[model samples]
Target: MLVDDQVPIEEFEGTEFPSPATVHMELRYVDRLLHIEGTVDADAKGVCDSCLDDVERHIHVDVDERLDPHSDRENDPFGESNVLAGNRLDLADLAQQLVLSDMPMGLRCSDECKGLCGICGANKNTGGCSCENDTENHGEPKMEDAAQ
Candidate 1:
């Protein structure tokens, strides 16, 4: 069987999906097992962890799993896909799980992002603030003395 469709999912773990995810998959039944293979693509919008900037990401993931009517999730060495509920696959849950799990931890706008200034509460990447942060000392020690 050929499955090609788009699924609309609003949010996952605080991250927002601005567009519907495109799924192109093929399912084949062999013996008592069902094999599923697909590719999922989506656009995600979120906040940068460091600078609090609006971060957008394009996610593309590959899915490959096999399911059966009787598969053990516990106590057995081998288990089918966790997206399987009862005798059918849960497409919505599958999309959310795959995308969220593949998402990066502590998403950032860039590697060289300067982030925000703790003293003046200003964004350093956007030309920085006028606060005297003791630039001569290389860090907060100079700012401490300047404040005193």
Candidate 2:
């Protein structure tokens, strides 16, 4: 979870990573600084950007950081900050920041995911609808929409 001192960074490759992945941390004490270099892997599952069906995707990240011990502000040279109280450090906050930093801004299952149809609620991936473009301005309105 947290690597305080200096050690080999952990490997989180393959499918063991969380849905959003956690940055693999390798710590090293250099003079008066802590250096971290590693990677993060995450397999996320969410509705397709084009379709409303479940889709799974992977996110990968490479991280390299340095933390200064004597600085008034416990911020890494990379501009990422860690709350440090003397020699004692908060691992929870550090991990949270790493995970958040590795998270993708915008992700999709596939570039060509044909999402659900707006009119008939049909999945376009399985040829459930012959609406051609799957536009919202199609055919008959649903009972819910008609009542409104």
What are the lDDT figures for the candidates, one per model? Answer: 0.77, 0.55
Could you give candidate 1's per-residue lDDT for residues 1-148 as a string of tens digits?
A: 8888888866866688988998888988878888889988988898888789898988898988677745633333344355666666667767777777778887778788888888887888896785645664467676788999
Per-prediction TM-score: 0.74, 0.55
Model 1 residue runs over 4 Å out of place are: 72-80, 130-133, 136-148
- C-alpha RMSD values across all candidates: 5.2, 9.0
Instruction: Spell out the clash pairs found in candidate 2.
Output: 50-115, 51-115
For model 2, residues 1-148, the per-residue Cα lDDT tens digits are 3443322222332212333344466767788787767765556555555665665566555657676655524445344444455555444445545644564554445667666777787877788886764344553455458889
How far does residue 92 in candidate 2 sit from its true spot (Å)? 4.0
TM-score of 2: 0.55
lDDT of 2 at 3: 47
